[model samples]
Target: MNTFQLSCFLAVAEYLNFAQAAKQLHVTHPAVSQQIQSLEKELNVKLFQRTTRSVKLTDEGKVFLWDAKQIVAISDRAKKRFGGVAGGNIETLSIGCYNFPCMFLLADTLETLRTIRPELHPRLQEIPFQHIYRMLEEGDLDAVVGFKESANVKINALYKEVAKVPMVCICSGSHSLAGQKELRLCDIKEERFVLFVPPKGMLSIAQTQGQLMGERPPSEFYFCESAEAITVLVKAGYGISVLPDFLVPDTPLISRIPLKDVDQVSFGIYYKSLQGNPALKAFIQCAKENLTALDI
Candidate 1:
């Protein structure tokens, strides 16, 4: 019903743990719980599933986070319609991004902006790919950079082709699969794979490879939502994973080989369909300057 109530609800829904949510909100655990209870009462539905050791969002809570954020964003933007700027200043650009290595684009953009206007400070949040769009629409972010997908979601790039990082199948350097210079999907048909999948969604990239193989090769698959987890699995020799080649060069223990027939992964800058924001426009321009180096 109110901003306070919605804020508490989303915080809890994000951390999925009362103490953690309270820490993030800088409030007491009881305070967080009280607000969530108030929201549940207002909505007449349970928003979460709770137990002694764990907390999880109910089906309703998952959907509510998006709509509630958008409402809050619109309200906040309405209050500061003129951006609190007198004439023109770089001000701020809030950005969210997937945990992909696509930050090179953002870095170039911000660096260029710094040279022209050093006062610019772009707030940044590292988020999952799926959350980027919702966060932008909610006013939490001005733009996002990650893999692009369509689902009534509009996306665009400052450059023609997608900005991409060369990703390769990484295994322990001395592992059996490391001997090959490059490999096809069939190379690891029977080996274990450390795959990254969304906590509540599909592994779109891995699925794309599966479809391209014509037949989904039987792989001993292990899935985790965290990219770090997947990397750890690869390090422990549990399985090889597809990761940005940038991350492997410094590691002496990991070896990355190309997926024989698969192409480089596509990544780009995405944002909601909205009029241009100056900070974002500047960043896009900087990103375009480095476009050729991105291997797009």
Candidate 2:
């Protein structure tokens, strides 16, 4: 009912752990619990099902989560609007990216946007991939910048592609496949696979790797939450992974081989609409003009 209660609810919903949510909100665990309890009492509905080991959202909580995000975003925007008016008219936009690498792709675009709209402040947040689009739809994020397949377009969302980067096979420098100039599916089918955790609402990179592997799948599979973890595993010769070239860091310890059959991923900005937002409109244009020029 109140912004405070909604904040507590959302933090709890995101983390699914009261202690972790309290840590994130910089509040004590009991305080968060009290807020959730009060909100549930006021609504006459249980928002969460809590036990000793885990906390899961109730049916009502799942339904309210989207609305809560929108409510908080509107509240934040209103505060920022008035606060900006009192402090020299500074506008802020929350931009979300999946990971650090995806965020790095915005460097040139953000710089270019600064020149055109100096008063527009872009707040870049590296959000989890699964939550990024959900946050965008709930208005917590004004826009998102990341890679998507060329064919992946949503009816309600708009994507402005800046550039296309090919997927590559990532392996340890000392691996047998490292000496290959280019790799095909069969070339590495027998090797162990390290893949990203399955994401929601977008194309699954792991699933794509599975399709590429076809009938002859790798004997072992390892899943990781981040590209960094995947890289670490590959460096230790645990397994190889397929990722966008930019996500692979430049290091002699790892080798990246161009994928012969995979389609290039389009790197771009995904926004709901540019009809009313001047900052987002300017950012999309800047990204289109500048991101294409990046060496990556």
Residue 233 CA displacement from its true place in model 2, Å: 0.1
What shift in Å separates residue 117 of candidate 2 from its native position after superposition?
Answer: 2.0
lDDT of 2 by residue, 156-220 (tens): 46778788787899999899888999988777777788888655223536556766556754458
Residue 14 lDDT in candidate 2: 96
Per-residue C-alpha lDDT of model 1 across residues 1-296, encoded as one tens digit per residue = 99878888878877888898899989999999899898899899999999998999889988798988998888788768666765455478777766644554467667777887676787878786656667767777777766545443454333223455565788887698888888776676656777766342223465643543344454567777755677778889887776555434347677778766665655556655436576667666676676546543
Best by lDDT: 2
Pick the TM-score winner: 2
Q: Cα RMSD to native, each candidate?
A: 17.1, 16.3
Error of 2 at 145 (Å): 1.5
Deviation in angstroms for 236 in model 2?
A: 0.4
